[model samples]
Target: MGRSFTVYVAVLAATGSFLFGYDSGVMTDVIESPNFLAYFQTTQTSAIVGAINSTFSGGAVIGSLQGGLTMDRFGRKKTIQMGALICLIGAVLQSAAQNLAMILTGRILAGGAVGLMSMSVPVYQAEVAHPRSRGLIVGLAQQMIGIGFIVSTWIGYGSLHAPETSQLQWRLPLAFQVVPALVLVIGMIFLPESPRYLIEEEQYGEAMRVLRKLHFDGTNDEWIEAEFFEIRRTIEAEKSVAVQGWAPMFTVPQWRTRMLHGVAVQVFTQMTGINVIGYYQTIMYKALGFTGNRNTLVAGLYNCVGPIANFIFVVFLLDRVGRRRPMLFGTLGISLALICEAALNSQNPDGQRIGYSIGGVFFLFAVSVIFSMSFGPCSWVYMAEVMPMQIRGKGNAFAVGVGNWAVSTLWNQVSPIALGQIEWRFYFVFVAWNLCVSFPVIYFLFPETKQKTLEEIDLLFAQRIERIPDEMTQREKEEAGVSAMNVENTKLHN
Candidate 1:
C-alpha cells in the first residue's frame, strides 16, 4: 500500500483497540459517581461492583472465540465491521440502562464486539502492512489503545463537571463509545479486505488486486509479485502441516513454544495488577484521601502518561531496541514498582494514614510509565508477531481468548473482592507473578524478533539454531536466495 493508505487502514482497524481501552477506562471514573453507586446498590457487596467491572471481560472471552470463526470465514474487514455494529448495539443498551442488570448486559454485549475487533485488527494490519515496518504498524493497535485510554478518562473527567443529576455524567460516556464504533463501520466499507485472507479463501485474482493496491502504485508489478510470492511460500508451508483445530498449537514443539509465548505474554501482562488500578483508580484515590475532582484530575494525569510512553516506545524504541530486552526490563521495573506500592500502602493498611500516601501515588504513576513502556504495546505486538500466516486469525483468537480475555476476567472478577479483603497485600500477588512467572517466561522462553520479517520468525522457531552464532547468518543466507529472485524480477525497473 502507499504510505498514507497503509496508515489509513492501520488507524481505522486500530479503532477496535481504541474501543477496548475506552470501554475499560470509562467505568473507572463512572464507578466513583455516588449516583451510580446509589443506583446500583452495590456498596455492601463489591462483587456486584466486580460483576459490573468484570462482565465485559467475561463477555469478551466469548466474543474473541466468535472472532476466530467469523474473521477467517468473513475476512478481516467484514469481521471488524460486524464487531463495530455489535459495539454500537451495546452502547445503545448501556446509554439507556435502567438498572445494574441492563448495564451489565450492555457491557457484556460490547465486550464481545471489542473482543472480535481486538483479535482481528492486529492480524489484518500485520498482513496488509509491509514487514519492514510491521512492528510499528501492528504495534499501532496498542498505541491507539493507549489513545483510547486517554480519550475515555478525559470523557469521564469532563462528565464529572456536568449537572449532578443530569445523568450525562455516566450515560453520555457510555453513549460516546458508539462514535468510534460508527466510524470504524463506515471506514471499513471503503477499505479492502486483507489480501492474505483472500488468498487463504482461494480468491487469488482478488488477492493480486489487493496486493497491487497495497504494495505499489499499480505500476510496480514486479515488486508486488515478489511480496506475494513470499506470502505464497509461507502459506504453502503452513498448509503442509496444518492441524484441524488447536492440536497443532500443542503438538508441534515449535508451534507449542510460540503458542505458549503468545499466551504467556498476554496472561502475564494482565496479572501485573493493571486492572486493579485501571478499574478502580478512583477508589484508590479516595482511600488515599483525594476526594472529588482531585481524584479525577490525578487519574486523568496518570492515564495520560500511558499513550505518550507507548508512542515513544512503538515509534523510537521497538524495532531498534528489540522486544525481549525492553519487555524484561519493563517487567522488572513493574515488579519493583509494585513492591514499592505494597510497602507504601502497608504503612496505611486501613488507609487512615492517608497523610503518607504521596509516595504511594508516585509509585502508582511510576508503574503506569513502566507498564506503558514495555508490556502495554509489546504484549499484543508479540502475540500478533508470533502466530503463523495460515492459522493467524484462529491462532491469535485462541491466544487472546484464553490468555488475554479469560485471565482478564479471572483477575477483574477477583480484584474488587481481593483488594477489598487483602488491601495493600494484594499488590504482592502481582509482584510474585512477575518475579516467579513473567520474568522467567520472557527471559528463557520468548525469542527475539526485532528486524526479522514475519516469515523469518517462522523459520527461526521451525528450524532451530543449536548454535547461537550461526542463527542469523544461516537465516540471512536462506532469505538472500529469495531476495535474489525478487531482485532479478525488479532489476530491470531500477
Candidate 2:
C-alpha cells in the first residue's frame, strides 16, 4: 500500500462513520417532522418520541461494548461487515414500521451498527496508517462523520414534505442509511485486514507480507523493516506479561492511565453536549420559536457548518495543535458558547422570534463551530492516539461504549423531557461541568502526542520509562526490548 492506496483503504473504511453520522443526525429532524409525529401517533415533545430516538443510542451502547470481542475474534473487516449487515436489517425494519415497537426495534439495530463502527473503524485506521499520517487517517473517521451529518440533515430537510398519509418523509431517510453500509461491506472485502491483528495471532509471514505491501514504496525497505521490528518488540513486551484477556489492560499502571485518559476525553466530549444538537436540533429550534420548515432548515444549515470546521481542523489543526491544548482550549470555548446560548434563551424577550434574530442565530452557529473545531474531532483522534496496540480494540470500545453511546443514550432518554421541563436552564449544567472537569483532567492527566509515532506512544506510557534517545528511532530502541525477551525465551529452552 503506497500513500494513495492507504488513503483509498481509509476512505472506504470511513464509510462506516458516514453511516454513524447519518443515523445519529437523521433522527434529529425526522423525529420532529409533523408527518412523522402524526404517522407515529406521538407529539413532538412526547416521552414516547424521546424513547424512540434514544433507543437507537441504547442499541449502540450494546454494539460498542460487544464490538471489541467480535473485532478481536473475527478481524476488522469482518466486524465492520457484520455491523453493515445488521444496519441494513435496521434500515429495512425502520422503513416498513407501522407502530412504535417496530420502529424502536429498528432504532436499536441501527444504533448497534453505529456503535460497532464507532469502536472498530477508528482502530482499523490507526493500525494501518503510516505514523506520519496516522493522525490524518484516524481524523478521517471524524471528517466523514461530519460529511454524514451534512448528508442526513439535507435528507431530512428534503423529505420533510411527504404527504401525512405517506410514510416517505421518515421512511426514505431511514432507508437511505443502507446505501453507505452496503458500500462499506463490499469495499472492505477488497481491503486487507489489519497487519497488527495478524501479528498478534502469530501470523508472521502474512504480517510481513502486509507490511511490505503497505510500507514498501519500492524504496523504503529499511523504514519498513524498522516498523516491522518495532511491532514485533511491542508484541514481545506484551507477551512477557503472560496475563491474557482484559487483565493485561489493568495490570500496568501506564496502560490503566492511558485507558482512563481515553475515557476522560470521551466523557468530556459527550458532556460538551454536541450530540444533543446532533440528535435534537429541530426541537431546539422549535423551542426557540422558529416554527415550521424554517426551523428545520435552520437546523440543517447549522449542521452544515460543523463538517467544514471539522475538515479545516483535521487538515490543519489536528497534527499541529496536539491533543491536550486543543481539548482544554476548546472546552473553554464550549463553556462560553453554552453560557451565551443559555443567556439568550433565558431572555426569550420576543419569544420564539429569537431563532430569526441575527445575534441569536450567530451564537447558535458559534457553539457548533467551537465544538466542531475542538471537541468533535479531538476526542476521537485523541482516544485513538493514546490506546496501545495490544488492547486498542477493547480499550477504545470501553471509551466509546461508556462515553459516546452510554452517556449519549442516557442523555437522549431524559433530554426531551428535560428540555420540555427546564428549557434554557439545562444548558447551564453542561457549561459548568465542562468548566469544572475538562481543564483539570487534561492539565493533570494527559500527555502531548503531536509528532510521536505509535511505538513512541508506547514509550511514553511504558512502566519502566527512559527518555526517547535523540539519535535512535523508536524502532531501533525497541530492538533492545526484544533482545531481553529473546534472552528469556532462550533460558526457557535451556
Candidate 3:
C-alpha cells in the first residue's frame, strides 16, 4: 500500500508536466489551420497571436518565482492543486476563445500553473526519496516532461487530421489537457506533505511518519533520524551564508556566480531552440519538404524520439558522466547540427528543393535527439540539483523564469517572423547562440554535481570551495570532523 501510494503520487504529480507540454505543443497544429486564422486578420491579430503564445511563457516565469515562495509556505500538494485549477481555466478559455485576447488570458493562467508544478514536483520528489534513489526520483519530472511532449504532439497531429466536421480535432485535444489537470488536483489532495517541509516546521514526528511511508522497506529508523538531523544542521549552516531575495542572489558573489550558471544553462537549453522544434516542427517539416499528414507524422516521430532518448540517458548515464560534461557535449553537438541545417537551407535559398529540404529537416530531428539525450532532460535535473536548498526554490525560479521569458520572447514571436522573412538566417541565430555562450557557462559557472548529495552541493557555495573535490574524496574530509576542506585537511594530514 505504501509503495503504491508513493508511485501514485509521483504519477499524479507528473500530470502537471503533461499539461505544460500539451499547451506548448498544441499550437503547432492549430497554427496551420486556415479556419483558425481566418477569424483573426493579420492587422489586428498579430499582437493577440503573440500575446496568446507568449502569455503562457510569461506566466510560467512569474509562476515559477511565485511557486518557490508558495511551496515553502503552502505545502507541495496545495501548490500543484492550485496549478491544476489554473490549467483548467486556461484550457477552457483556449477551447472557447472568441477573440485572441481571451486565448492570451487563458494561456497566462495556464503558464503560471505549470511554473508552480515544475518547481514543486521535483522538490517534493527529492525530499521524499532515499539518498541512493534521489537522482532517479527527482529525474522523474524530467522524464515526464519528455513524455508530455510526445503525447501532445501525437494528439495534436491526430486531432488536426480528423474529418472537417471533427471540431473534436483541435478543440478536443485542447480540452484533453484539462483531464490531466483535473487528475492532478484530485490526487494531490490526499498526498503527504514533504518530510523536509514538516521538519522545517518543527514537526519531527510527522516528518518521520512521512519518511517511513515513502520508504516502505522497513529501512532503519535510525538512518531516517540521522538524515533528519543532517538536514536540520545543513539548514542551520546555510542560514548564515544563504542569501535572501534579489539582493543576495543578484549581488552576493558566490550566490550570483551560481545563479549565473543556473541562468546560462537554461538559456542555452532554450536557445537550442528545442521548444521551437516541439511547437513548430510540423510547420518546419512542411516548409522544408514534407506536406499534409506526412509532415504531422514526422513531427510526431520527432516528439516521440526526444522522451525516449531522455529516458535512456537520464536513467543510465546521468549519475555516471555527471552534469557539466553532458551539458557541454550536448550543447556543442546541437550547435553543430543546427549549423549544418543552416548551411543546407542557405544553399537552397528559395526553399524549393524537396530533397535538400527533407535532408535539412532530418538533420533537425537528429539535433532534437542529441538535445533530448543531453540537454533537454539533463539540464533541468542538473539545475534542480545545483542550487542551495536555502535559496534553491527562489533561485531556480528566477533563473528558469528568465529563460522561459527569453524562450517566449524569442522562439514564440521570432519564429513566425523568421519563417516569413529570413528563413535561412533563423537556424543561424540558434547556432550562434549555442556556440558562443554554452562553453563559457559550463567552464566557469556550472559546478560538478555527480554523485554528490543535495546537502553536499549546498555546502559548496556556503564554504565557497575555490577548488571542488571529487565526491569520493569529499567523503574523506567528513571523516576528520569537517565537511569542507580548510581546517579538516591539515588535521587529516597530521
Total clashes in model 1, counting residue pairs 3 or more apart in sequence or in different chains: 2
lDDT of 3 by residue, 1-494 (tens): 44556666666677777777777777766665445655555421254555666777888888888887887678777887888898888889888877778777887888888887776677677666665555566666777787777777778777777775555565666677788888888878778887777756656567767767776466454444456555555655556465556577777676676777677777888888887767667656766767777777787788777778777886787767777788888878888888888778777766689778878877888897898777766667677766666666677777777865546555676676566577667877877777787777677767787666667666655643333222324543343223353422322110
For model 2, residues 305-377, the per-residue Cα lDDT tens digits are 8888888887787877777787888888888877887777777744555444545566778878888788777
Q: CA shift at 475, candidate 3, in angstroms?
A: 31
Q: Which parts of model 1 have CA positions greater than 4 angstroms off?
A: 217-223, 349-355, 463-494
Q: Write the per-residue lDDT of candidate 1 for residues 318-405, one digit (tens) a residue.
A: 8777778878988799989989887877787655675567777888888888888888878877888888775677778888888888
Against the true structure, whose TM-score is highest? 2
RMSD (Cα, Å) of candidate 2? 5.5
RMSD of each: 5.6, 5.5, 6.4
Alpha-carbon lDDT, every model: 0.80, 0.80, 0.70
Stronger candidate by TM-score (1 vs 3): 1
